[model samples]
Target: MFGWHVPAPDQAMLISGGKSRGEAGLPFRIVTGHGAFVVPVMRRVTYLTLSLMESVIEEACVTQQGIGLAVKGVIAFKVGSDQASIAAAAQRFLADQDRMSVLTGQIFAGHLRSIVGSMTVEDIIRERQKLAEQVLEASKLEMANLGLVVDSLQIQSIDDRGSGYINSLAAPHQAAIQQAAKIAQAQADQAAAEAQQASAQKQSEFARATAVKQAEYQSEIDQAQATAQQSGPLAEAKAQQAVLEEQAKVAAKNAELREAELVAEVVKPAQAEAERIRLLAQADADRTKLSAQASAAEGRIALDQAIIAQLPQMMQAAADGLANANLTILNGTDGLNDAVAQLAAQGSTILQTVMQGLAAHHDVGQQGGAGDRTDPPALGPGPDDDAAR
Candidate 1:
């Protein structure tokens, strides 16, 4: 185990030895495995790493513009994984593995100078990727000879010695960008101020409108309250008017009833009494008229009977008077009878006149009185009648 060796995953182990040193064509074999053994007296083992490596180069090179430019760059490389390439690398660097980075940097430095010298200062500064590509292409074959592969090359910076060329190139574009930024900021500020003023105006108008509407509502509420307060008094006045109207109707009915009672109690009895008195007076007047008519008829009958009785007496008296008258007898007995007849006719005439006077006086008395007198007047004796007595 003392002479045993194991290689890492990224390394190769080489064994070189023989019994007498040249018995087997310099006695070398490459081993890539976990472990390998070597006899201490007959063989020797060496380990070679197979990892990626990086190198940086800084050099002053002259460009095609006849200006000296400082070029700085980085290169990445690795030992090839093929057997021949690995064997070539192991033979050269097995004694000192650190020499791989130094050799790679020297190779990249020489190629970077050659590529920069073929271009102008502007191309080296602006087209740095093109410069790196050309350097990598040129260094490819040389790195292969050293059992290396060039993975990438990068040109970091290119500068002229203390010249103001780069600042002069960027001046106009920088000034244009600053001017555009100032214009955009001024436009944004103006738009924001206008929006703020419009919002304030709208808020003020809304507040004023709300206050006016509220005042109108309050006025309506007050008017409604006033109307409510007066309703009770108005209703009471209407009720009083209705009560007075009912009382008036009752009084008028009572007056009509009193008028009817007066007509029945006073006027009706008076009218009946007046009618009774008028009938009694009419009856009395009729009785008086009938009584006067009856009396007048009885008196007229009595007077006619008395005048008949007196006519006989007056004829007798006339006969006596003729007897008493003495006369000579010229014709004897015939002449005396003629004188008696003449006297008798004269007495009859007087009796007729008296009866006529008595009837006339009775008629006069009845016409002059209102049923007071209805009898005939009495007659006196005639003048011839008294002489006879």
Candidate 2:
């Protein structure tokens, strides 16, 4: 209705309890003044008031530092209590719920996205004091543009979940380094054990070879000693046998020399002496036989002479004896004949005795005389003495 009538700057309207002056692009107010004529028109004054509990759901932007954030929390603003600005805000912005509630929410959302997009989470967490002031300043301009005067601005909290995501990416590389170190240590231990085993095997082989060589050398020495021990006695026995054979040959030579000297010196002389002795014995035996015969004849002649003389005597006596016998026979014929036969036998016996005595005496003298017969002389070749005869 006020748009239809024009009021001069000097015009007065009733408000509160008195008349007040007028201005364009401002809310009308009632006023009191001195006597002036009233004019009638097709315009009237209207009044509006708001309760204390009414709130405008609008956004306010805040930039936080050190607590760097990409999402924001709740922000709140209220209209001021100043009457002049209140009247102006109510007239321009309070006409409908769409501009005050919906349109204001959209504008605040844009401001918050714009400010937070360029910041990090660390910037918001470290800069809390600076962030509260920035929210108040930005809310003042936004509220005025919506024909509202800001009474108070506040910042609640900033959200931070982006910081934890960055630290998770680097964990896998650290685990791989620890695994590689353990594998290298195991390989070094295995190499050391193999080297020790090889050294032990080589030492054992050398010791075994040395022991075998020593044993072979000892065996050869023992064989040589045994050969020397056996050979010495065999050589000594052969030398003794040779000496005995040579002694036997020398004794045989001595016996042959003794036999040859006997034949030359003694045997020939003994045989010649034996032959001369035999010749001398034959000559002596012949001489002795001739001498014996001559002596025997002489002794026989002497005995015959004596016998003849005795025979003459014997004949005479015999005659005388025979005559005596005949005379007796005449006395006794038988006695006489016996006496004659006895006398004839006695005569014949005496004659035979005389002849045998002569032969015996001849033999006695040829041998030797009766005195020489006791020991006869050696008859054969009386030494060499008969050689002269």
Q: Rate the local accuracy (lDDT) of all candidates.
A: 0.76, 0.51
Off by over 4 Å in 1: 19-27, 183-389
TM-score for each prediction? 0.48, 0.28
Off by over 4 Å in 2: 1-21, 24-27, 30-72, 145-147, 160-389
Note the residue pairs that clash in candidate 1. none
Tens digits of per-residue lDDT for model 2, 1-389: 42333333333332221243344434345332333323334234433233222233233323334433444444444434445545555565444523454554455556555555445444545665555456556666767654454444344555444554223333454456556666766776777677777777777777787788778778777877776677668657767767777776776776677666665666665666667777777776666677567556655565566666566556556656465442534558888677667666765677677658667656765677433422221122234322322
Quote the positional error of residue 214 for candidate 2 in Å.
92
Q: What's model 1's overall lDDT?
A: 0.76
lDDT of 1 by residue, 362-382 (tens): 566456543555454444445
